[model samples]
Target: MNSRTPRPPHGSSRAGPPPRPGRRTFGAVCAAVGALVLAAPGCGVLSPGSNGQTSDDITVTSTMIREGEAIPARFTCKGEGVSPPLRWSGLPDETESLAIIVDDPESVGGAAVHWVLYGLDPENPELPEGTVPQNGKQGQNSKEQAAYDPPCPSGDTAHEFRFTVYALKADIALPDGAPLDQALGAVASNTLARGRLIATGGR
Candidate 1:
């Protein structure tokens, strides 16, 4: 006098529920970030790069490349060999000038300075792509030339390049085409704040 339900299924082929729409895969997240980077491609302080310690207010960025990303060949010897668009922000009010250094620490001899620029207008925080320094003067690089020596890594893998900006109390007084060491020393002495962006390049 009791009623019971019977089951007909064994090892059913029915599918589980679809993945949650709210969840994001690693590749999806990276693609989204890369798209954001591509959308912004000129010299303006859009966002911060890989300089992790946020305690420092100053930041440097390049619209051409993101942190740990490949620098465009147009900015390297393989292409047009011009400087990429760069910008910065978070300078203190006392800042009278700014400086920039692009170098490769993984050089054959030692740290190879690629490009050096100082005496930038602190109030202005943009260096347009392929543009030469206006108020600031360019300095010598590892190649012993006072110009942007684009990255030319010989190996299969790309080399890390650093683009550092220094907020200075006053303009660096070194003569144009001054030695890299002297220019670097001047920046270090007068720097009030600093930030950097690391990029990659290869032949």
Candidate 2:
């Protein structure tokens, strides 16, 4: 599990110009961002605030589990399989929308997505336990269903499950029950900043 990032060192300067827009599709853009290639110089980091300062990172926290720790059965397939309560803070002031994804990257075939959620308003950054945002759209995960899929790793090997939140410069347009890759692409193209929370789960 990673610790909170310390604030960017002091010494304010003029905020840079808005990042140059890219002409690529959302999927390619997302792959670049995910790889930290950033497409091009001006297309990477988002614009800072009027004060030439970036807002705090959008962090995700949960009362359900701690970083790198085992998740209780009540939140997994062996139990109720409910989505955990999540709260976010330090959102960039200019954030227009947000996206959330929960997945396991160590699955046998590849990254196994457990949840694909999007369209959360920046105004409110909390998702209550066992619920989804009213206006948000749910995407289909590896299970081919548009809902929360509990972490159910095979055997006794503990698995790491990540809950990531992406702050976007604008609201993303997505159809209901979109596929995982499509959801990620929309998120990557407009991502301003991203935060994450991780936990472990095992049968």
**Best candidate, lDDT-wise?**
2
Error of 2 at 122 (Å): 1.2
- Per-residue lDDT tens digits of candidate 1, residues 48-109? 33223212477888888899887777888789877888889888777787888777655444
Off by over 4 Å in 1: 1-55
Clashing residue pairs in candidate 1 (N, C-alpha, C atoms within 3 angstroms): none
Residue 11, candidate 2: how far off, in angstroms? 42
Models 1 onward score TM values of 0.69, 0.71
User: What root-mean-square deviation over C-alphas does model 2 reach?
Assistant: 13.1
Alpha-carbon runs more than 4 Å astray in model 2? 1-56
* Predicted candidate 2 versus true structure: per-residue lDDT over 1-203, tens digit per residue: 12333332221111212323322232343354353212223332122231233343777889887877877787788888888878788777667878887877554544466777888766665777777666677876666667777777666665778787777777788876776567766766677676777888655
Error in Å for residue 103 of model 2: 0.7
